[model samples]
Target: MDDPQRSLLYRWPTAAKFDRRVPKEKLYEHGTGTPAVREKFVAEVQRITWAFKLAETTINLAGNTAVPEIQIFEIDAKGTNVTEPVLTAIDKAIPFPIIFEINRDDGETRSTRMVAAHKQLGSGAPKIGAYYSTGWQSARTERQSLPTAITLPALYTALLDPLTPMAARPGEDVSEVAARLKAMRKLEREIAALERKLRTETQFNRKVELRRALKTKQAELTMLVER
Candidate 1:
């Protein structure tokens, strides 16, 4: 289970700040090609701001060919929640990896959360993997200084460390962590489906078969979690 109290609000350096507003239409051009995605943007999103740019020039970090810079986009949401498809559209539009700070205003107070996918440069387009997110926290939450790292890629990994479901092993990179999390998600889904089937299963023989399958999937998930 994800720790709801583990929300991290990074104190972005002044040098790395690039507080620019991003137009929703710009995302529509390439990202929200589908009607459903476009509609989600219009309905759920209030505004998009390109809040920061972490790069070699701005932060004095060494440039990496795979990740030259990391972008932070602050999304002002119209409601308490924005769908994942809306986020997926924005990720599709941007070439670089992005960290999203989603803010929502209720009648009494405002809340914020950090969200991002493990993104990598692909041949045609960036390969965006499963998203990791921190639970909603108070907008007034104290911020922590950015994690120390040698390069942009390392910084990106450090930024996402708090959001991932599982901790990375000694030699594991962000990509490896993402892959493991993805597999875990798949196994979780399978287990849920099997459980649902078991609940409705009537025949004794069918129940036995489902039980066996469920046990196998559960064992697989346990191994992944322990690793």
Candidate 2:
């Protein structure tokens, strides 16, 4: 006999991001239950655990017969925050746009974007609606709740501190301040170029740590200009 559920859960359309294929008979039976699509979704997610770094995964039946949410392990920051349920809590997303945060090892946070929704398909296997999504990328992240005060923490190593910011448009007293800034920028360029030239992982990580150390000094300089 054919493993119908697995069939529906794994098959993918030619170019679509997910599996929306469903059997005609089951569509009459449970297609009314929710997305005959989400079941296949979570399975696809399970297949890509390597990319997402997702640990555990669970799919729950929601009241909506067309949209199922997901719970996926996120190894990143927020220490395993419940994922799919968070998506469901949002506007019962259709074209499913999800926004979440990832904690980086360096005490900084990264923002993530995902989608969870329906994919209407032609005749094939059937499954529940899943928390649909593409993937995550590093992007701007603001501090929690306190949205206005800080912007994304700009990435600048202290090495860059000596560089002048806002290169003066005209000869506005190229003061001591300007020269220091120019020199800092030059040093930063040298460091970055050196990093790019290296091929060893050990050396690369070392350079990265060095860059981060400079971040503190860089922050102080920018802060000074702010005042």
Candidate 3:
């Protein structure tokens, strides 16, 4: 039988950064019901698990139906000093535009505005929206209630619509960010392979060669990172 859900198995190379930096951090703990969320969740799993059987099972399970429409994860930093750190990390990790809602301990919910709304600059280039809003149902205002469900079609529209620009953060060049990410991911894979080879090879000369290759790969990664 043809696997319809195989289409959801897109690669998420940037997810490895989270894996390397925060090894113990649980991923996909909360599901985002939209296809966008499903896509992201699948990528996170694939980034961590190398087993083909596991990936296949996951893909089959996810193919059952649309997931819920939740963002990457929700933070309950209300009245907490660590809110900025949590928000900052989220901003750095997710390049695309998203909406965040902050619910206070008093049962009051206020939105922190959508990260990047697209606007037309006079020079014919698009810019992130200056004004912040509560929800992302439309680009016009911020007072709308949270969406009850995010279908696959809605998620696709949010991402692919050219009229609705999705780049939200300041000074964020989507194409540049994407290119750098691709390079870093490639370097990461090369470094991993070299390290694995180093572990299994006990010959003194081969070990030295592997170490040298590892160092060179690390250096390349560093340069791309520092750039």
Candidate 4:
């Protein structure tokens, strides 16, 4: 049985601070004095914060599951529990799948890592007297058996296969809708780029040429959107 409080499989190495120049004695340091480094660091951290916000919906959905566990390792570029403001906000937003660990850098002595390795080798060392499971036994094991999330590609494909809509349209499948949406988004991006270029263009002849190109792109975008 798994402990409810210890379920969230959070893992993060030490935080890497953003420094302008290479430190003489330190791997990374807070950019306190350097304005350029400070600005860059702030921007990068903001970008990461936005990414978490974007994935918030999915994270919330996962949190409601029977054995909920949220992984916060990947999002932390500057180690566990280092940043104050952004992390606090994210923590508040995530009500489910309570955080288990902040710094997972102590893998050298972790028994979970040992169990995972033992399982990979088709050995019964992780558990007592269990052996001879055929063909990639890890995927079939219950969710609570592993400390970390499953990384098998085929298992993921099999799990997500049923989520594919049965009949999206009369003659169209989900993949076609996805492809069409991708193409439409591409055209929209190209149109936006051309418009930005048209704004910066100075020469009269060049502006005229840009206008024609922009018009063509806009027409294509309209067609794609309508389809």
Candidate 5:
């Protein structure tokens, strides 16, 4: 397995810094909804800061129409974990794609993790895919320079590559990698279900059938892995 903490953190340029503290109320006002989500924010999130903005103007990279700017938001977490709903709410409220840095303090030590979903802009709303994250590392972990790219969209893809479960194949972009990951996730779930069913089956014929189905799912997963 690759070290996720390696080449994963970037030293953002001072020219692109947007050190604004984003109020939780502002997120709710901008369309992050439901009483449940609001409550989660209150209970689990201590602060939200708009830490940096990567754009053509700030970074000298050309911007794509679909991805004009990338925003980096840092969340000071109140607990060890922040649920998906909390993240989804923030993604929905923000129009642009965002990279989240979640920081937590355990009194003796401070740790940080990176989390984000592949966000796409459609005609009506921004479509967010499953989240990808890195395991927690010390706050003092060494940082790396940003991935080399000529455009914001390309840079976005490069940044997300490290967080994905599978390495991107030659000629594959972020969207393609995301689609493959979704398929892999589906196959994983089906394989688990089949294995569980096989464990308790007593009849010889039923066990045989379950095993056949489980083998098929496992083969499919293997193919995806090889890709």
Candidate 6:
């Protein structure tokens, strides 16, 4: 059986902080510094305050210049008595499905060393998951959409697919899929407003055409989401 506190148990690895330049000798020392202490404080804090454990650390390294960047993605602690690790106000709930990336320091040619990322606007915990699932259900309503939230050939005409896509996927710099989704929503709103306004002004044929288009869109979305 799934753990009841599973939601509290898993979080996106977030709250990243790291010094690009760490003196080898001072490494351990700096690791104990005030900042380091606070970061490490997570452990002690959890011991005294929360009833949770941050079991994973996701690190992503980037940059090629003199300084290299180490991005620390962490799942920290929260709450003291409950089965869940509830995050404090200042402390953030981790993003769902932890993600991050690292790249080699190759002078001019910095190819992909490592890239781990997620798709969707990570809202963290239950809210994020809900948004993700709901978004998919909404998108699935329009399966035939040439330009849908789903990715396809670049040649696919977004104007035809009629749904908004996303922006900045986790690993990639950014994806336009989000943008497409937004655009589709705006278009829908405009159409809806017009329909409401025209209900009294427009004729039956016009309404029929609009209804047909809407049904078609809904059907296509259903196809994409369902299968």
lDDT of 5 by residue, 102-218 (tens): 899978998888888888866777888888888788888788889888888888888888887777776666677778888999999999999898998899999999999999999
**Model 3 segments beyond 4 Å from truth?**
1-96, 99-172
**What is the alpha-carbon lDDT for the whole of candidate 2?**
0.30
Winner by TM-score: 5
Writing each residue's lDDT as its tens digit, candidate 3 over 1-227 gives: 11222111112223211222221133222222445444433333222221121111322222112211212223333242122323333333433333333322323433222222222223322233322223222122223322221342233223222222122123334344445556766889999999999999989999999999999999988777662
Taking all chains together, the TM-score of candidate 6 against the true structure is: 0.27
Q: Rank the candidates by lDDT, best first.
A: 1, 5, 3, 4, 2, 6
Clashing pairs for model 5 are none
Name the regions of candidate 6 deviating beyond 4 angstroms. 1-15, 18-58, 61-173, 216-227
Model 4, span 27-117: residue lDDT tens: 1132122454443335433123211111223322222121233322123233222233333333333332112112212234211110000
CA lDDT of each candidate?
A: 0.86, 0.30, 0.36, 0.32, 0.84, 0.29
Among all windows of 10 consecutive residues in model 3, the one with the lowest summed lDDT is: 1-10
lDDT tens digits, residue span 65-86, model 2: 1212222222233332225533
Query: Model 3: clashing residue pairs?
Result: 32-68, 33-67, 33-68, 33-69, 34-68, 116-168, 134-142
Question: Which of the two candidates, 2 or 4, achieves a greater TM-score against the reference?
Answer: 4
Model 1, 1-227: lDDT tens digits are 23576778888999989999989878977764688878888999999999999999999997566687899999999988777888888889998889999999977889888999888776777878877788888899999999988888888888887788777665566677788888999999999999999999999999999999999999998888664
- What C-alpha lDDT does candidate 4 achieve relative to the native structure? 0.32
- TM-score result, candidate 4: 0.28
Ranking of predictions according to TM-score: 5, 1, 3, 4, 6, 2
Task: Give the TM-score (vs. native) of candidate 3.
Answer: 0.31
CA displacement after TM-score superposition, residue 96 of candidate 6 (Å): 20
The local lDDT score (0 to 100) that residue 149 gets in candidate 3 is 17
- TM-scores for all candidates? 0.86, 0.19, 0.31, 0.28, 0.88, 0.27
